[model samples]
Target: MGEVDPAFVQELEHRPKQGIIEAEGLPIIDLSILSSSDATPDHSQALEGLVKQVGNACRDWGFFQVINHRVSMEKREKIFNASGKFFAQPLEEKNKIRRDEKRVLGYYDAEHTKNVRDCVKKLT
Candidate 1:
């Protein structure tokens, strides 16, 4: 909404225009075959298909949703609950894991996208 940072502008200069190229929908990848124990020819074909789908998704969209992943629903729910608990913690507690400016790891409250920046190095 304000003047975009020159560095950010430079970063976007070579990227494709937003919304210029659209895939039919968000890419979805199934991982069931890769996890199967059977090594039949059909399973091999499925695995090959899986690899191609993953590669195309990475090339076209950079990321995609996965189905039939190994993690159980219970573990997924636990992860969600833990995320909620951490996000709900007091500011002082959350700051302990503040991600520094240069690193992409740890936690933060705000995100920057397009040309907007929000500060969130600490919970407050």
Candidate 2:
């Protein structure tokens, strides 16, 4: 988008870009093992490994993708469709629920990130 704000450009110039070079990719954690309730010894060990994977993913990346989470594709699609509709609204309409000092659980138009990019996100 047009040139980034000069202030943001300056900030980016001073920060290290090491994280990008160090990152492999977003971590992917399987939820299938955690969902089982089997009492076998192997199951317990597997569960522990799963937990460790989750902890590492959180501590290092702050987030991770989960597979075999058991949610139906239809339900996921519904959520995606709804989100699409919500974000597609005009800025004026979205601003009706804009987050402010008094509330921290609504739409945020421009969230600043360490990389000098603006991210639009909603919190609920």
Candidate 3:
């Protein structure tokens, strides 16, 4: 909750900061379809559009992203704020929440997933 420690900010300066080498815009799945009575059993009005986007993303790009899933920006900010506090803890303290390979759910690092590593690569 206090000001972020200066040394911690300095430490992040050493992490990777390269630009993305390859990139593609992903389709955004809107959650509004879930509540629409007009939607099909699979919750689709743009069902074919969603299917095409998802199919292309998986078959060609290997992954996709979602958007407009109904979380407000205010709620999203709170989540990020809580995340900052959790990540700010020292490794000894943070490791308590580290997830195991089998029970992976908690604060797992970037070393385990190529998908995340690739995204970081693309982002940086």
For this target, which candidate reaches the highest TM-score against the unseen true structure? 2
How much is 73 displaced in model 1, in angstroms? 1.9
Best by lDDT: 2
TM-score of 1: 0.54
| TM-scores for the candidates | 0.54, 0.62, 0.53
Q: How would you encode candidate 3's per-residue C-alpha lDDT over 35-104 as one tens digit per residue?
A: 5577465555466667677787676556667666778879978987797788779988888878897767
In model 1, the number of clashes is 0
- Give per-residue lDDT, candidate 3, residue 64: 64
Q: Kindly report which residue stretches of model 1 are placed more than 4 angstroms away from their true locations once superposed.
A: 1-23, 37-49, 101-104, 116-124
lDDT of 3: 0.61
TM-score of 2: 0.62
Each candidate's lDDT (Cα)?
0.75, 0.79, 0.61
Ranking by TM-score: 2, 1, 3
Residue 110's lDDT within candidate 1 is 67
Candidates 1 and 2 compared: the better one by TM-score is 2
Better-scoring candidate (lDDT), 2 or 3: 2
Can you write out model 2's per-residue Cα lDDT over 1-124, one digit (the tens) per residue? 6875664563656554677527767789998986788999999999889999999988766678899999998998899889889989999999999999998889986776565555435443
